[model samples]
Target: MAKTRTDLINQVLDRLNILVYGQSPSLEDVQRADRIVDGAIAKLASLDIYYVQDPGQAGPSGGAIEDEAFLPLADYIASFHLLADARTQALAQIAEAELRTIAAPARTLRTLRVDPALTPRRYGYYRGGI
Candidate 1:
């Protein structure tokens, strides 16, 4: 089953220890987390490493990323946004590193060609037999 935005927000809140068992987060906090998740998605889209689709709608009830691997990335980013402490920052960094490993950038191979006419022969050798 695909996870929803609420799941992502809850995961982030859990990571930040903002939402504990038997307690629900406030509506304002939930909205804040939703925005944070959107920002995280935007950040990933900006990297161009992955193709992220629009969340379609806005709010915690909106759709979520299908890629399970990217879920943690969103969680870490949202957690950092909720709590920009050194630890959260480090976790975010680690998440990014893991993302790079999961989806390494594509490398294009390039070829170099040299035209004989453009190439210079020996120092004393002339092109026109001069």
Candidate 2:
């Protein structure tokens, strides 16, 4: 699992609450994290994924297809997947930068992973006792 904005936000919030409350999270807050993570995933899917011309633009007329509307959606699928992957990677990087909240990550490990707070990160940024 890669970190997204929600993960980063939750991690930071946890850190802040620890600083302010000098304590751990309640069971309700733990359950709310689960809901927040799921909602972020659902929200992310609504973004427009890619900008490339559609495959259908190849054209039956032999002339170049002109209108963007003529393109097939699948052509954009690869681009969106790529974008999503990149977004995941980026999110991990952001979380990694918040290492003040996690165990000190190794130099090599940092380069090899993003937001270990997620799975690949192993940073233990979660609240329910990683």
Candidate 3:
């Protein structure tokens, strides 16, 4: 089963050590974390780590990211936003690296060749083949 946005937020709170067993985070905190999660998702999309074109499409009510492995990236990003400490920053960086590793397989590279015959030249004075 895929993890929901709430689950991601809870994970972030856990990482920050704020939502303990006997305590609950406030609504404001949860909302703030939700926004942070949205930002994190946007960042991932921007980096081509996550394929979703629009980050808002994966909101709390909307469908969640099916790949559970990427959840940690979102959690770390949200946690870092909630608490900008050295440890959180390190964790976020590591998560980004891990995400890149996970996403590497899905990415592809292609090279295109240009034919000299088709090239447009305003004189072609700089062509010297050695």
Candidate 4:
């Protein structure tokens, strides 16, 4: 998983075959590639991840979390998937599902995940003795 913007950019570029290992990129190619990466990152930054980010920053304000790194991985992967399909101008069903998951993750491990504070009690069911 990518921990930084540079890492994320490199991974996407590699996936797109825009850059290959054992070869240096030309300045023009680098600039063009970086533009695409920046576009994807900007799209990703619009997600509702639990992080403090500056007005203009593309990532967390205080930097990304190391222990809970899956958040960033999901963001980068979703962004890359979007970029790869830019020509289509529409995301695949799988990409849409991934983006949805990133935006609102489900708590499916438990059979019932509800907020006790928000749950209303039935007054009729209450009793003074057991």
- TM-scores of the candidates are 0.66, 0.26, 0.65, 0.43
CA lDDT of every candidate? 0.67, 0.33, 0.65, 0.46
lDDT of 2 at 84: 39
Residue by residue across 85-127, what tens digits does model 2's lDDT show? 5644454444333322233344663545556467663455557
- Determine the backbone clash count of candidate 1: 0
| Clash count per candidate | 0, 2, 0, 0
Worst 10 residues of 3 by lDDT: 52-61
Decide which is better by TM-score, 1 or 2: 1
How far in Å is the alpha carbon of 95 misplaced in model 3?
0.5
Q: How far is candidate 4 from the true structure (C-alpha RMSD, Å)?
A: 9.1
lDDT of 3 by residue, 1-130 (tens): 6656666666777777778786777787777777777667777878787553323333345445456454556645654473668877777777777777766675356677899899787664767779
Displacement of the residue 20 alpha carbon in candidate 3, Å? 0.8
Runs off by more than 4 Å, candidate 1: 54-56, 79-82, 105-130
TM-score of 1: 0.66
The reply for model 3, stretches above 4 Å from the true place, is 52-59, 79-82, 106-130
Q: Write the per-residue lDDT of candidate 1 for residues 1-130, one digit (tens) a residue.
A: 5666676677777777787797888898878777776667776778864544545355666664566555556645654463667777777777776676667655667677889899888577456953
- Give candidate 1's whole-model lDDT: 0.67
| Model number with the top lDDT | 1
Over 11-119, each residue of candidate 4 has an lDDT whose tens digit, in order, gives 4455555677976656565455555544544555665433323222343122332324333443344344435555322333344455455557668687877999999
